[model samples]
Target: MAHLQPKTIVIVGGSLGGLFLGVALKQLRKNLNIRVLERNPTCLLHDQGAGIVAGQDVQEFFQRHDRTHTPLAVTSHQRLYLDRKGNVIDSEDKQQHMTSWDLLYHVLRANFDGVDSEYAKAPEPQDNEGTAVYGYGHQVGDVEIDGAKPLVIHTTTADGNTATFEADLLVGADGPSSTIRKLIDPSVQRTYAGYVAWRGTVPETAVSPAARDVFVEKFPFFHSNGVQILAYTIPGPHGAVAPGTRLLNWVWYVNYAEDSREHVDLMTDKEGTRHHVTLPPGGIQDAVWTHQKEAAQASLPPQFAELVAMTTVPFVQAVTDVISPAAVLGRDARVLLLGDALAGFRPHTAASTNQAALDAMALAEAVGRIVEGEDAAEVLGEWEARVLEYAREGQRRGVEMGQRSQFGVHPLRG
Candidate 1:
């Protein structure tokens, strides 16, 4: 009898979703080879200074997988609603954990491939474990799959060199603009939600005493006609969580009709380049940000306006929604779509990261069954059906919440 050969899995996209799946698979099966390909040329991704609401699944993932045990989030003890005058009108006792994108990315990278950084230290490599590789600057050009043959992935390096890789399975976690998703199903596309979020963050020490008092340790929100702004505390630079070192992250959602002149202008950066989804920090034009600040002063609560004024480099992200018809694709179901590639949810639900964690956890649970002589197609088919339902439900809830908040229309009335 011949010994069974280990299966090779190739994951495209080194962001949170891809990293989550890679780490989970590496931990679950020591004999499975995993390779992660990222299009970004640099090893470290940009911080973006975005805050993520750590759902239950996310916290559990870290607890189960992360060995460093570094404090991952800042806890918000209450939810507060303020009027235009910054006076609290209503409050509820609720606790939530907030974390930074950079911190989470670094922690996952450490766990996936034993890469050490300022935020997390890598652990010692396990004996008898399969190989784990992370390839940066590798932009996937195309994927080819033949029946009963290994999948072929073609890529071009940053230096313009081309290479090929073979894998038993291909996973696409490359986010909303995923190249793999397009190849698999080009019919699915993202639709803009008629609004955009103007986001910024300020250091805790920089906030005024009055502003700090109202926002610190609380998830604060202010809603006006067709607009909403919210804020929470998150880890600061280099994942610092100390009182003075933390950051107060804020996002203000404003309505803009699709393709309107105002929308076009807002999406244009200072360099005269138009962006589709996000305008990163330092890209916003001076006039655009100045106008937004003036609007904030007139419409936002005094504390919210003050925080916006203190922001040095504010960014903007266009809200969008996308739901694919299927999660598993191609002959024999060898290709898989995960995370935003599977469904791009509105930010209202704050379930994007949590959804990715859930997908990773579910797949990890299914791998053992497939390895134990179960039909691969049947097992993966079941997994796909479960996650696709989850993604659709999340997308539906996000749309309803966004309509109620942004358009002031209840789903029942509609």
Candidate 2:
């Protein structure tokens, strides 16, 4: 009997979601060829300096996949709510783990492509694992899928050179603006949540002793009409988690009416580019930042206000929600969407990264079953049902949380 050919799996978008799925699948099967295409030309992605709440799934992902013993997060020992007057109004002992986006990305990249960085050093590849490739500067332009046939992908390089490749399975882990998602189902669209998060980070060393005393070791929050702010410590530059080395990350969600002048002006960068989703650090215009700082000072607790004032470069991300009609696509179910490509939850629930981790692990298990002589279509169908439910529930909860926090509207009583 002749041995079957190894399957080719292609993943678009090399961010957390794609890397998570790529690493998980690579670890499980040796008779596979995996390629992760990243649009960014540089090997290293810019540090967003944003904090991620390390939910249970995120921790479990690291526990199972991370080979590096390096520390990854800072611990918040309690939930602290501050009144507008800067006095503690409510406090509860609740521990939560926080990590930086840079830290997580570097760690996952190292594990997936055996790349060494300041945050994580890659280990030797296991002999049982398949070939894994990370291609940067490859922008996917088009895709073609046919019934029970290998999928075709066309990509264009930075220099405009085009290339085509074939894959037995295509995974769309690309984020909210995923080209794959558009190709799969254009009807589904992301709906803006009528607000934006003003985000910034201050190094622990830069924060005043008084502010540190109030925020350190605590997950702090402040809520008022039409706005909500939260802060926590996360690993600093290059994954530093030591007491004095970590960074204080804060996010203030403020309402902005769609197409309003304030919204339009805030989303416009210094370079005159209009950003739909995010205005990156240093890209925010001076006037916008100044006005936002004024708003922060007037509305926020003193400590929170001080943190915003101390920030050198602030960023903004428009909150949005999206849930795809289906997770598994294509006539053969060989095409799939994962992570933000499948569902983008509002940030209020802090479930975005957790959802990605969960999706990756669940798909890995399903793939494992398929590798063990199980039917691929049947296994993937079951996986799709499970993940869709998870994503929908997360999306619903995030929207509810956003509603309650931003508008003070509780869920309707039956």
Return the top candidate by lDDT. 1
In candidate 2, stretches whose alpha carbon ends up further than 4 angstroms from where it belongs are 1-6, 409-414
What stretches of model 1 exceed 4 Å from their correct place?
A: 1-6, 409-414
Candidate 1 lDDT, tens digit per residue, 1-414?
A: 011122788999999999999888888755788999999999878888898999998999999888778889999999888888888888899999999899999999998898899898998777645778999999999999887788999999989999899987888999987899898888988889999988889998898898998788789888876788899999998799988889999989899998899999999998999998999999999999999999989888889999999999899999998988888888667888888889988988989999899888787666656666567777788899999998999999999988878999432221
Per-prediction TM-score: 0.96, 0.96
Model 2, 1-414: lDDT tens per residue?
A: 012122688999898899888888888856578999888888767877789999999999998988776688898999887878778877889889999899999999888888898899998878778788998888998888775567899999867898888988888998987788888788888889889999999987787777887778788888888888889999988898888888999999999998899999999999899999999889989998999899889888889999999999889999998889899886656779999999998888888899999999998887777767777767787899999999999999998899887878422210
lDDT over C-alpha atoms for residue 70 of model 2: 66
User: Lowest-lDDT window of 10 residues in candidate 1?
Assistant: 1-10
- The 0-to-1 C-alpha lDDT of every candidate, in the order given, reads 0.87, 0.86
lDDT of 1: 0.87
